[model samples]
Target: MPITPVKSTKLYHLIVEQLKQLIQSGEYRPGDKLPPERELAQRLRVSRAPVREALVALELLDVVEGRVGDGWFVKRAPDSSLDVSSVEGRPPSDILQARVLVECAIAEQVAAHHDDELVVGLHQAVEAFADELRRGQLNGEADRSFHLLLARASGNAVFADLVAYLWDLQNGQFFRLVEGMTGNERPRLERYVREHRAVYEAVETGDAGRARDAMRIHLEGVAKDLLDS
Candidate 1:
C-alpha cells in the first residue's frame, strides 16, 4: 500500500515494515501487547537499538503506546494516513555515534586553546543546564547552549555550526522520543549532570586528550543508559 512504503536504509524502518505486516496480519491486534524487546530483537536477528527505535517510532505515530514497566501495545490499526514511513529521523543511537566523533574533537580542540572567558562560559553553561535539569526539563535552552559553547570554544565557526546541526537533529521530534522515554528516572538525571561536569573539569584543566576521553565516555554512557543497555 501507498507506493510500496517509503524506501530507506534505516534498520528501524525495516523493522517498522515487519511490524506493520504483523499488525495487518492480525498477529498483533489492537489492544494486544507485543513481544518484549529482547524477544523482538531475537526474532529480527538484530540488537536492541533498532528494535527500541522502531518501537519509539511506532509510539510517535500513535500506532502503539508504552506503559511504564510494560512493553509496547498496539493502539490502532495503520491507516493509509499512517505508514511505516511516518517515523523519520536518525535514531538516538546514531546521533550519539556521530557525536562521539565530532564533539570529542571539539572538546579536544577547545581544551588546548580556551581563554578565561571560555572557561567562565563553560562553567555558566554547566550550571544553566543543571538548573533546567533540576526543573525536569531535558531539552532546555541551557542544555543546547552548553554543547554549542563547547564547539564555539574551539574558535572555529564551522565547528559551532556543525554542533548546532547535530543538536538540531538531537532535538528532532523522532530523536527526542528516545529521551522522553527515559522519563523521570532520577539516576539518569543525576548521572547526566555528573558527566557534563566531568567534561567541563577536563577542559578546565587544559588536558586536550583527557577532555576528549571524557566526552567519549559521557556520550557512550548516555547511549548505554538511554538506548543500548
Candidate 2:
C-alpha cells in the first residue's frame, strides 16, 4: 500500500469532523436544529468563518440540512469519518492532475459559449497579470486569478467553485513549495504571463480547439516542472 503523508488539520475541517461526531454520537439527532453560528463559534472557541465553512461543507456531505431563515439541522449521521485532511495536505502533483482534467475541459466550454461578462472578466484577468508581472510583485495570485477567470467563463458554478478551491490549495501549498525551491521569481513570472496571454487570446478568438490545446499544453508544462523540481 502507498503511504499517505501526514497532514495538518484545517480549522474548518476540524469543525466539520467535530460536528459530525456530535451528530453520529446522538448528541444531535436527525431533525435537531443546530445552534446559531455565533453559538457554535463560541462553543468551539473558533471564529465564525470556520463554523460557516463547516456548515457549508456538511450540507454538501448531506449530513446537515439548512432551511432558509430557520437554521441548520442534522439531516443524517455519517457512516464513516469525513476526513478532509488530504485536502489540506494535497501534493502539487495531485493539484496539477486535477487542473489538467478540469481546466482543460473548461477552456473548451468558455470558447463555445461567448458571454460579454466572461470576455470582460478574462481581459481583466490578463490585464491584472500583466500589471502585476511588470511591477515585480507578481506571485501565484496573478496566475491563479487568470485561470479562475477562465473557469468562471465556463458558466458552470460548480466548476468555477472547484477551480477556485484548487487555486487556493495550489497557492497555499504547492506554489510556496515551488518558491522555496526556486527562490528567484522573475523567470517564472515572465513565463506565466506569456502562457496566460496565449490562453486568453485563444478564448478571445472563439477558437475552442486552440483554447483547449493551449490550456492543456500550459498545464502539462506546469505539471512537468513541478514534478521534475
Candidate 3:
C-alpha cells in the first residue's frame, strides 16, 4: 500500500526534523552534497513539493545551500555557543545600542527589497503575536519571527544569519527581563504586540521611511522600559 499524503505543514516539518537528525548524526556532514531529488523523494516517501519547501526552509536557517546545477549541500553546523549568561550585569545601554544598529540596518534593507512574500510572512507573524498576547502568553517567539522575517526580506543572507545569532544570544535575557518587568503590569504585554504590528504595517505598506521609523521607535521604547524598571 502507498503512503497517505502528508499535510503541507506537517510534511515540511517532518522533512526538517529528519534532515536535522541526519545532520546531527553526521550522515549529512557539512559540505556533503545531498542526494538528488528523486533519491530523497523515494527515501522520505514524500512528493518533491514538500521536500523543496523543506529545503527552502533549511536554506533560510543557513543549514544548506543549493548550487546551480550540482545539488543541495550542507552548509554549517548550528552554533550552540551563544553565551547569554555573560550579558547579565552588562550595561543595558550597550545592549540597546547594539539592537538599534542591527534593527535599523534590517529595516533599511527590507525597505530596499520590498518582497511581497516577506511582507506577507511579517503580517502573519504580527497576527500570531497578537493572538499570543490575547491568550496571556509571552510573545517572544513571534517577536523573534518578525525580526527573522525582516532579515530574510533584506535579501542579504549574511544579515539574516547574523540576526538569528543575535537573537539566540539575547533571547534568554529578554525573557528574564519580561518576567521581571511584568510583575506589576500584565497589561503592558498588549503594548508589545501593538508595537510589533506597527512595524509590520509600515513594512507591508512599502513605506521604507515609515518602516525604519517604526522599528526605531519600538526599540527605543524597549530601551526606555528596561532603564525605567
Candidate 4:
C-alpha cells in the first residue's frame, strides 16, 4: 500500500507556500500567465479550493491580476524609477488631500462622541511610540500604531480601519523614503512629534475644529518637506 500522506497542515496554507516559492524563484515571471486553476490543482495534487485561496492571497499583494475572462496573470514588476524619498514617496500634495478628506471627517465624528476609554488608549499608544522613537527604533509598526490609536479615538471604526489599511499598504515605501533623508533633515522628526502632540491636545480639550486644523497644518508641513527635497 502507498504510505499515507501527512495530513498535518491546512491545504490552503500549503498551496500558498508552494505558490509563493514558485513566484519567488521566477518560475512564474512577472506578466506570465498562471496555469488554469484546474491545471494547477491537478499538478499540485490539491483541490481547487486551496488553489483558489492561494490565488486570492497573491492578488492582495498585487502580485497577480485576475482578468474577467482570461486566467490570472502575473502583475508587472513595480516601477523602480518611482521616487520614494521620505519627503517624496508620498507627494506632500497627495498626502494633504488625503488627510483633509479622511482625517477631517474623522475629527468631526470624534467630536460628536467622546469616549474616555478610547482617549486613554490613544495616550498609551502615543507613549509607546515616544519610547520607540527615543530608542531609535522608529519602525513602521510603531508609527502606524500611533496613528491608528488616534483614528480609533475619533469614535469612528470605519475611519480607523480605512486609515490602518492605507498605512499598512504604504508604510514600507514610506519608511524607505524617510530613510534616504540626510541628518540635517532630522528636525522633521521633532516636528512630527510636536505636531502629534498638538492634535492630542486639541482632542483633550474637546475642540473638534482645532483638532482638524492641527491635523491639516501637520500634513501641510509634511507636504512642504516632500516638495522641498
Give the C-alpha lDDT of model 4. 0.69
Q: For residues 1-229, what per-residue lDDT tens digits would candidate 3 score against the true structure? A: 2243666447888898788778978888998999987789889999998899888988988989988788999997644434354345456677777778888878966876678888888889888878877787774677788788888888888888777866665554555666666665455657777888887777777777887888898888878887786
**lDDT (CA) for every model shown?**
0.81, 0.81, 0.77, 0.69
* lDDT tens per residue, model 1, 6-35: 668789988988998899889889999999
Report the C-alpha lDDT of model 2 over 74-174, residue by residue, as the tens digit: 88887744233435767788888899899999998898786767888888888888888787765567778788778877878889888887777766665
Better of 2 and 3 by lDDT: 2
Cα deviation of 119, candidate 4, in Å: 1.2
Q: In model 4, where is the ten-residue run with the lowest total lDDT?
A: 78-87
Summarize candidate 4's per-residue lDDT along 1-229 as a digit string, tens digits. Answer: 2244577377886786677678777888898999999999999998898898888877876778889789999884423322233233454456557756787667655655657776677667666766766777655356577677778876668888777655543544445456667465446766777777777777777788887888788777866776666
When sorted by TM-score, best at the front, the candidate numbers are: 2, 4, 3, 1
Candidate 1 vs candidate 4: the lDDT winner is 1
Return the TM-score for each candidate structure.
0.57, 0.70, 0.59, 0.60
Candidate 1, lDDT over the whole model: 0.81
